[model samples]
Target chain A: MKWDFTSVFANTDALLAGAAGTLRIFAICLVLGLSLGLVVGLGRYARTWWFYLPATAFVEFFRNTPVLVQILWFYFALPMLLPFEISPLMAASLGISLNSAAFSAEIYRAGIQSIDRGQWDGARALGMRWAQAMRRIVLPQAIKRMLPALTNRAIEIFKMTTLASAVAYVELLQQGKLIASLNYNPIEAYTAVAVIFLVFLWPLVQFTYVLERRLKRDE
Target chain B: MAYQWDFTPVLANAPLLAQGLLNTLKVTGTSLVFGLALGLALALLRLSSRRTFAWPAGLVIEVFRTTPPLVQLFWFFFALPLLVGIEMTAFMAAVVTFSIQSAAFFAEVFRGGIVSIERGQWDGARAIGMNHGQALRRIVLPQAVKRMIPAFMERAIELMKTTTLVATISYADLLFAANEIAQKTFRPLETFTVAALIYFVVIFAFSLVARQFERRLAVSGESTVR
Candidate 1:
């Protein structure tokens, strides 16, 4: 068996397109997931049942189910109920973003909960309401502690973008499939794809490690 | 017009879905067992002072942990066969990929648990004339494994969810079964909903049990490693 990557390298345009698709979805999911997660996390942290119960349910349902199932459901089943068709990008984004939101909500909740009570008390003493305290005092400090975990979530989200390929979204892995089938070079094609992901993610993974170590040292 | 909901077709194919669920469990269980064993080996190697043993194990863990499971699955299923000159079945591919992928995760859990064991435990074992391996097996591991239970359970649950990826490679796991049923019955709404619900029930039950165990450990004042 000989190793050959000329076939893979020859299809630079295809791979470049896949990388763009991967980055686009990753950006969408990251922004949507992290922001929505803050809302849900706050809901979970709420004292009232109305806020807590629904947030808990949303987190539980999304966390327990596989992301692939959710993506497939959105892609295949959801259109049945909707007036218009759901695109691959839309379905995959919905599944990944919601799943990331559910997972990250826990991170946010834990981050918030880890803050000292005195911080809240001090905020209150300064004439701050709940919203004001959370936005100005609690979240700023909490986000520092949450940074490492949030970075890890971002990595997971990046890895998950590949699953969009299952629904035929033109992600990195999907393009690898195209190259492999076209060139009959699954070995080179797949290896190149894996290498590309490693190149993209390894630095991020190392950065998270650095953040974790620094956080550990600081705390 | 309202899209009328129907479950008749989905219900009629209960047996197929059930079989799929069983296959899903089968893959999960198989992968979990192998992953745990391989993970221990990798952890041990990684923890070794010898650079040769530790470096390769670290590479394997990082590479597997870093790559997406679906990419690993495709490589094992498609690329491996031609490289190794063997016929790779979907089940075999799924098992191999998930076991290794999950093993990479489990390796960290083992390393963390082992590291969490205090230096005094090692000293105490050595004072009693126990060798390194003997001390590890008799002293360190027994204590470490207890602390690792929560982490192990969490990784096991993640592995179960990941088994769904096998469906992409044409493995007739629960999700694949759902696809076939949906196509055959043209009741994708009902079919996928049931499939997702089934996964939720099984995985959620496991989560509850794990949480219960974690609580017990907490009540006992045992610090568990993540």
Candidate 2:
């Protein structure tokens, strides 16, 4: 009956902490995922079957399944497989990062493939090793080309961190659920969290649009 | 560390998992149809010549697309009942949420396809004594649907993946069943792994089928073009 947000505002600190948790996981996933994706993407681009096969399989398996399922697996199954006990937070992060890595590998591969064949040949003509050519001639351009898609994926990963709540990671959505249940104002609590997410994500969407335009202009 | 690997508990829970998988498919299949139909309406509304219809439709699409599906599920499950003063079953809540959330994404897919249809095609249809509706139905949509296939498959995969979020609302979907089994047997690893494998197999199979469909469509499209 009421549209009041008094209770929602009262828990600003908790909400902010939740937002910070979400961002923390997003940043860690971005760093780890991009690096892993680069290696896998390079492997996929490699001429050697040994490098290509496993990388392709990893990407396919991870990409095919849902991230939520993967997170649950990491939280539960991974602890059984490894000797060290993994915290729920750590498990969620690893699952999310691996999922992101699979997607990023595809994006990076597309970018690298988009470059002219002459570029690779030119690098080889300069007597550079495969690694050196990829580093010196290929990756810089691919990074630029893949920036928009990668940023979009970053936003996706950021949005997906809300899934960590299912594993009890106390992220933004989980905090909202807690606040809503505690205050008994589910409408107001959810609205506040949704607004916060919108504020955070809207800019990234706009940034991608701008990047797309700039890239198109350059082309 | 010689911890014995055991699948006994997980295997014993096969019926429950199978039931969960069925529920998942039912939810996904029903929502996919509902979402696409609703999305078609939304896309048309947004593309309408009238500002009154277009702006509201655009706003609805933007808000739903921008927010997380998990939050949207929570909103439908927890908040809607509060506002309406009527309790809904978790399955009902999930179906409603998934439908609307997917409608937002599917609306974009339709809009993208519709927009890509050349302006001259519409005029050509009109030149052939077709009305606006006829032109859209007969001329524009056929070509547009082809362009929309790949995007549609991508969204379908996403929708299927997102169905897992219904578990958070206690809908007894595959993921929820896995969690329940894990809790009961104290074999979280085995239970979750089984669930994950089920998910991977289903999705991978669908992806293969979709690829083949795309290829067939492409070949037919080329022949028609020639």
Candidate 3:
């Protein structure tokens, strides 16, 4: 079959809207996930057993299962579990955020652990409280060290958002699939979408590589 | 008000779920074996002296790595038949799609492992008159494989989760089975909850084992160096 790429262009407006939807989910999830990660990471990093135990359990549960299943669970099951209904978009965002949070927690834990013990001692010696030392000293360096890993998580979250398509959330991939089914030319349709994803992701991937190298140089 | 739970439907469909789990494992295991071989080849191709081999290999890895695996699965399951004029079962499409997609990632892991070897080791092998192939196979890979184990296991665990994507194409994997039973029984919550638990248990156990193996490997690796 001769591939006719022109057919994909017929629904350009829809595809663009879908791209925006994808970005919106990514943006929301990024903020929520990072905040959750910080909380969980701090909990796990703390000496107290109560905080550590729940944090560890949360991370393990989210990390171990597939995000696709999680999304499905949120979409179909959450309504049953909870008192209210959730839009498909909200479910997808929640699922992705919770999943990303688990990975991010690990990244944060590793980053916090990588900070020199002496640095902590120095902060304490300066008469700063524990919270102040963490915020004013340890977190800054840990955030720098964690930048590449966090960026990678961000990218993974972006990719996982495509699973929103399964929930009928009309993301870029879903819109492309709709177009393909309409046109009976999935090759052309999906090829264009793949190119769009490549174009979208290449810069972020490059940025991570550059950031990693720059951070290494400072060491 | 509290919600009432029902697991009777899920329990009755245990055999179907078991079959689906077997299918999921089959798809993941076969793809993993082939993917590892293809990934190692791509890694070598990327590192080859000849630009002819390296350039396209790089492009393939970049494209595959960057795109969502679901799109790849759709492309294979739906579009490829029209393009190639060859029909495929959903399982075949999944296996092929996953192998190709995973090769891109595993290639990176392999490359990282190979590059982690000290420069002197490569030079020492060359000094002993081992050709590139001999050195890679006999010396470098033996050492590199140890370093690669953790990454490889991580990828394998990832691939196990990924096998659920086959359900999108109507392949009756674990997720598909759960979805079917849920819809049939009008018990989506309980059915899905059971399915999620199964996945968590399987993957969690694998991760625990991998962590243990990795710890042991780290100790052994350190001791050997000492």
Candidate 4:
């Protein structure tokens, strides 16, 4: 009937555990995603049909499909086909990693593409191979150019980690749902949950904004 | 030891799925229209000069835009009725959550477009003795809308994609339907793959149409293509 924080934050300890779980996934997924993205992204740009086309399709499939569906398919359906029954937690983590990789691939691609055309020419003109130039001259600049977008992407992916709850993972939203179901205080529970997300997300948001401005001035 | 592709089970339910597809379009289309209208209002208000006018609207846009719409939808469907002591249907909850989400995004897109205009145009419009609303309407807004078409399409595609999240709450859009069918059929790979294909088709079509619109809207008397 009225607002109640008593039940949701009935204690700070439980909320801390929930918030910690969120950060763990957020950090783990970012690492997994960025690593996978770097490899797949480089392969996509390598222009080898043996790899590029499949990598491109992989990127598109993950990027375009809803992350929630991907998580569902991985958790519910993937094990049925695999030789072994995979755990849901593994599936959730891997699915999030895979989906984020798809998006990160694009970020990588854009970062690579943003490199000056002349940089490529200059490297080719010298003794450096295509890979060498990309590594030496281009990627460094591209990396700098891309930090803002990458931070922004990371912020979004962190926000998106909430979707992991749909597969029954006990992220912030699900914790709130559980608390609400128990105490029957949906607003305070959700508000607490939303505030947790906001607290987590706000610093990243401000950092990205400041980072973007800083990078622009550097240009 | 293999997840062989199977479409027969899903295809068997095509007629049923087709109805669901129609429902998905209904939610996406209806929300797009109403949300854009509300978003335009938010954008205009955000752009308004008065301190009293812009701050509240800005705060709303910031809050809604930053948070996940699913959480917002949860608040709306479950919390709002309880808080306000009146229940809205699931469909109403979905529509309101989505419209509110779209309005935030549209405000940003529209605001960006408005800000992109040159200072000289504003001076000229105001110099002509036109009121603020008239200058904005007759001179500034038309050009801004045209500039914003590309963004509108991009936002439309994003909003449509986001509609799938509605299923996270109890709304039976395409993803929810797929979840139901998959659970019954136990055809996760099949149903969801097919679901992905259907989404790709809709988004692809929307993108094509949006691109066509962008090309059409490109001024014929344009200066050198920059």
Interface RMSD list for the candidates: 0.5, 1.0, 0.8, 1.7
Q: Candidate 3: which pairs clash?
A: none
A122-176 in candidate 1: lDDT tens per residue? 9999999999999999999999999999999999999999999999999999999
**Of candidates 3 and 2, the better by TM-score:** 3
What do the candidate models score in CA lDDT, each in turn? 0.97, 0.89, 0.89, 0.80
Judged by DockQ cut-offs, the docking class of candidate 2 is: high
What is the per-residue lDDT of model 4 for residues B1-226, given as tens digits with 9 covering 90 to 100?
Answer: 4567777888887766677677778878888998899898998888888879899899888788788777888888878888888878877887898898898988888887778777888899989898878878898777778778877887887778777777877677788888888887878878877887888777777777876877776655321110
- For each candidate in turn, give its C-alpha RMSD to the true structure in angstroms: 0.6, 2.2, 1.9, 2.7
How well does each candidate superpose onto the true structure, as a TM-score? 0.99, 0.96, 0.97, 0.92
Q: Which candidate leads in TM-score?
A: 1
| Candidate 2 chain B minimal-lDDT segment of 10 residues | B217-226
Better of 1 and 4 by DockQ: 1
Residue A70 displacement in candidate 3 (angstroms)? 0.5
For residues B1-226, could you state the per-residue lDDT of candidate 1 as single tens digits?
A: 7999999999999999999999999999999999999999999999999999999999999999999899999999999999999999999999999999999999999999999999999999999999999999999999999999999999999999999999999889999999999999999999999999999999999999999999999999999999
- Candidate 3: TM-score? 0.97
Top model by DockQ, which number?
1
Candidate with better TM-score, 1 vs 3:
1
Q: What are the candidates' individual DockQ scores? A: 0.90, 0.81, 0.81, 0.59
Docking class of 4: medium
Query: Which is the leading candidate under lDDT?
Result: 1
- Superposition error at B16 for model 1 (Å): 0.4
- Write the residue-wise lDDT of candidate 2 on B1-226 in tens digits: 7767799999999999999999999889988999999999999999999999999999889888888888888888888898989988988888898888889989988887888888999999999899999999999988888778877887898899999988888888999999999999999888888898899999999988877877887787632110
